[model samples]
Target: MLKAGEELDMRINELKKYDTITIDNLKEIIDTHLFLTNVFSDISGHNNRSLASKYLHFHVPNMFYIFDSRAIQGAKSYVMSDKQLRASLAPFGDKEYIELVIRLFTFQEHVKSQFGMTVTPRVIDSFLLNY
Candidate 1:
């Protein structure tokens, strides 16, 4: 697990391996996310978070999160549609909405520490759309 205030640079490097990203990568992201409903609810799975490598595959590499209405609000300025909002979440099964808020807030903290900007999820989604 990530420690409080751990450096995100190294983590970013690791995440890049699976980052075959593009504006059109949403299709892949959507497909990947759609699998979560069955996967997360399963009692057992090889790619589950009980394993370190598997956990990273789910979170770090995919850069995906469960749903949060607040995150949708934060992403409002970036994506204009509910569709785009839905797309960003296309990677996780149903999760406690607060977890999204916490995870996203942590991401915002990482960005502020590294780049000195307090970006909302909207800014993040905008970047990902073009990234």
Candidate 2:
């Protein structure tokens, strides 16, 4: 989710406007979610302490909160028309939804493996059909 309720360009510009990020400033972000800093560590591959502090600013700056529904619809609309939206909203063209289904398929494979059950396309197709 986008914590900053603005375009990515605006977010970058805002950071450039500020020379440095301080420790006291990050306290408020941690107050809501302590594990927030760790989320960016793996992606940036930054060292623990120093990198974490910088990652925290990149993820969520002081006083900047997440807007759950960002300008995603607007961005998509500019790229695609209203007719395309109606067609794509249905499961077929939805990459995110398709990825979710594939993830669930993997989860099912793990659960079956635990029971010594072999996974096959037929089984997955059946499960998808039943659901």
- TM-score against native, each model: 0.34, 0.23
Total clashes in model 2, counting residue pairs 3 or more apart in sequence or in different chains: 0
For residues 15-40, write the lDDT of model 1, one tens digit per residue.
Answer: 44654333344334333433433344
lDDT of 1 at 103: 47
Give per-candidate clash totals.
4, 0
Residue 39, model 1: lDDT of 49
Error of 1 at 21 (Å): 3.7
lDDT tens digits, residues 4-93, model 2?
324433534544453322223222222222233333444565423323334434454432221111222322322332334334333332
Error of 1 at 111 (Å): 14
